[model samples]
Target: MKRTIPLAIVLTMGITMMVQFFVPHPVSVGYYDLTTRWIRIVGAFALVLGTGSFIMFHSDKVRRRRQGWYYSIISLVALVVTTVIGLGWGIRPGSILQNVIYANFLVPLNASMFAILAFYMASAAYRAFRARTKEAALLLIAAFIVMLGMVPIGASIWGKLPELAEWVLSVPNMAAKRAIIFGVALGGIATSLKVILGIERGWLGGGKQ
Candidate 1:
């Protein structure tokens, strides 16, 4: 009975949403709007649940004197500070304090995090590009060709290198990426339909235990 009720709710909401997209009739539109607003309220509750879980997990680690307690403390402080500042003084983009916090802290932190990816990429490339097989050798050659194409000096020496890079990037690379993206899109649509149909009931704790 519990499973049946939730399944009915999901099917009703989901089908109404899809039909609203295509039909746009008054009844369908009203039903869609009502369901969307209810979903937003549920979403707010979900956010509270997420934040409460974050606090509980970190607080538990702090209480246990975990290896990275200091980092957790830093995170908690940052969260509290941001919440208080935004709530107390508002978070308008042009506000002096908001601009200062973003320019001084957020921008540099984001840049540094992105820069760390360079080291990981270097380590992975070292492991990946060993000339152990014909395929690996071919990939190494392509990588060097692409790297050379990016630099003015190498491009000047080999006039066709830049053209080769352009072809690689525009043709095969884009085709492969598009194929993978289309597959992912189809998979996502299938999963979403399953969820709406209540076949994917693990999301609701296997239909209320």
Candidate 2:
């Protein structure tokens, strides 16, 4: 009964949401709005549940004095401090949470993370641009044209290089992008159907159907 009730709810909600896309009736719109509000309420409860799980998991690690337990302690401290600041001070524009914590701490941390990611991206690009095969050679040439076209030096070397790059981007790149999007859309539809029909039981615990 436990699994059956949840599965039924999921099936009903999934089919209703999908059908609502094709439905233009006032009733359908009302239902959509009602469900969305309920979703937000559920989301608040989920957030609380998630926080509890996080604290418990980290606390266990810290209690065991496991490897890198200091990191877990730091995480727990950060969570508590951030939560208290946000709740107590209010996250208004001039509040300490916004001005000090967000602007001074979070913003710089995010920027640093992104800066590190840029190096990884450059490394990946270098490996991808290596021309060993015919496909790789073509990709390298296209990438070269695109990169050079964005610069003034390319126009000085060849005036038509920018136009050629634009063609490669608009025509071949866009076509491939659309094809990939279509494939993704189809895959999502298939997955949704599997879940709705109870064919996908992975979401159920213990790998049981």
Candidate 3:
């Protein structure tokens, strides 16, 4: 009975939403609009619930003095400080939260994180581009051409390198991208249908309905 009621509501709403997409009647459109508005209200409550859970989880860690508990304290402090600042000053342009916390702190932190990520990406690329096999050699050559073509040195070395790079990108790269997108779309549809039909009950929390 605990999960049954929620599952029933989900099934009804899912079918209604799917039907509304195909049937453009006034009633269907109005129901969709009303449901969306209700969704926003529900989302607000969910946010509050999530925040409570986050605080409780960190608070337990801090109380237990677990390994790396200091990081949890920092997380909690940051959350509270940001929440207070946002609520007190508002996050508008030129506000203290925007100019001080965001511009001065967050922007540089994000840039530094991305800089570190670039090194990791380069390391991965170096390993992947090793020309041990024929396929690996082909990939390495394509990657080399693409990278070099973006710079002035490639044009200086060979006049047609840029055009060759453009063809590789527009032809093979785009074809692969479209194939992946089609696969993803079909998978999404299958997953959605499973959820709508209640075949996917993992959302109910326990293993296998």
Candidate 4:
């Protein structure tokens, strides 16, 4: 009984949503709009649940004198400050204090996070690149080619290197990204259907029907 209820909702909503794509009627369009709204509501509720969980976890860490209590304090302070500022004064980029927050806090923090990726990439290259075996040697060669191809030095030395880099990035890279994106889009539609029909009860946590 427990499984059957959710399964039935999933089947009903999934079929209706798929059919709505073909149907061109007022009723079908209405159903689609209603389902979309329900999905949005569920998403908002999920955010609330997530925020509550985050606060509870951090509060417990702070209470227990955890090693990362300082980070917890910082996170809570940032959240409260941001919320109060946004609510009290409009969150406009033109606002001096908001601009200060963005300049001093958000821009520096996010930019630094991304800047660390270069160091991480260097470390990874050091560890991974070894001309040990046939496949490893081929990979090392390809990595070196791609890395150097992006720089003016290699492209200047070998004129075709930049062309090869462009082909790899535009063709194979785009194809792989498109495949992943298609799969993600399908998954999102399926999940939205399940949520609207209340089939994904785990989002609400298990409880008595």
Candidate 5:
């Protein structure tokens, strides 16, 4: 009964939303806006669920004294401290502690993480861009042109390199990006249809056998 009710709700909402997209009536627009608000309410509830799950997992690890439990403690402390600060004092820029913590600690930490990510990406790129295959060679060439086109040195070497690179990006790259987006949209529509029609019941839980 529980599963059936949720499935029916999903099917009805999904079909209505799809229909509203095609119908330009004021009534349809109102319904679409209503659905969007409902979505935000559901998202708030989901965030609470997610935070609870995160805390529970980390707490369990800390209690069990698992490997690297110190890190779990640090994570929990950070989460709690941040949440308290945001809630207690509205995160207005002029708020002293909030602004200080965010600007000095969080911003630097985020930037450092991104810097570390760049090194990892560089390592991965080295492996992936190696000209071991024809496809890899083409990728390497495209990457080289793109990187060179962004800088002044390439123009010094060949005045046309930048123009050629811009054309490559606008022409082939743009077309390929559009093709991928269309493919993804079609795949999403297919998957959503399957779910609404009850063919994708894996979301219901283990009793689906």
Candidate 6:
């Protein structure tokens, strides 16, 4: 009964949304506006659910004194502080709480994470660019040229290297990127259709129905 009710709702909403896309009538537009409002309300409820789950999960880790429990404590404290500030002060720019938590705490933390990620990317790039084969050698040369082309030293050595890099980026790189994006879009459409058709039931917390 529980599964059936949710599936019915999903099917109805999915079909309705699809039909509205083809219909340009005022009623269809009204449905679009109404659904957006419902989306916000549903999203608010989801945030409350997610926050509760996060707090409970971290609190349980802290209670059990698990490895890295100290980090869990920090997570909970940060969550509480951020939530309280957002609710109390409305998170307006230049607010004291926003400045302290977002500017002082989050900005530096995010920067440090990305800074570490840059090192990992460099290591991975070094591994990939190792000239083990013809393809790898070509990749290494292209990457080196591109890197050199971005700086003043390349201009001193070969002023045309930058133009070659620009051509490579605009042509081959963009072509590959567009192909990847097209494949990803097709995959997304497939998944969306499967969900709308109820072929994918994973989101309802179980395997396919």
Residue range 1-209, candidate 3, lDDT tens digits = 78888889889999999889999999999999999999999988988878999999999999999899999999999999998999999978899899999999899998998889888988987676578899978888888899999789989999999999999999999999999999999999999889888899887897544
Global lDDT scores for all candidate models: 0.84, 0.91, 0.91, 0.82, 0.89, 0.87
Candidate 6: where is the Cα deviation over 4 Å? 122-128, 151-153, 207-209
Error of 4 at 45 (Å): 3.1
- Backbone clashes, each candidate: 0, 0, 0, 0, 0, 0
Candidate 6: lDDT of 61?
Answer: 96
Q: Against the true structure, what is each candidate's TM-score?
A: 0.81, 0.89, 0.90, 0.74, 0.90, 0.86
lDDT of 1 by residue, 47-151 (tens): 888889989988888999999998998888888887777778887877644687778888999999999999999998878658999988887887787788878
Please state every model's RMSD to the true fold in angstroms. Answer: 2.9, 2.2, 2.2, 4.1, 2.1, 2.5
Clashing pairs in 4: none
lDDT (Cα, tens digit) per residue for candidate 2, span 74-189: 99999989989999999778998999999999999989988898888899886765788999888889889999987888899899988988999999999999999999999999
**Weakest lDDT window of 10 consecutive positions for candidate 1:** 200-209
Best by lDDT: 2
Question: Regarding TM-score, does 3 or 6 come out ahead?
Answer: 3
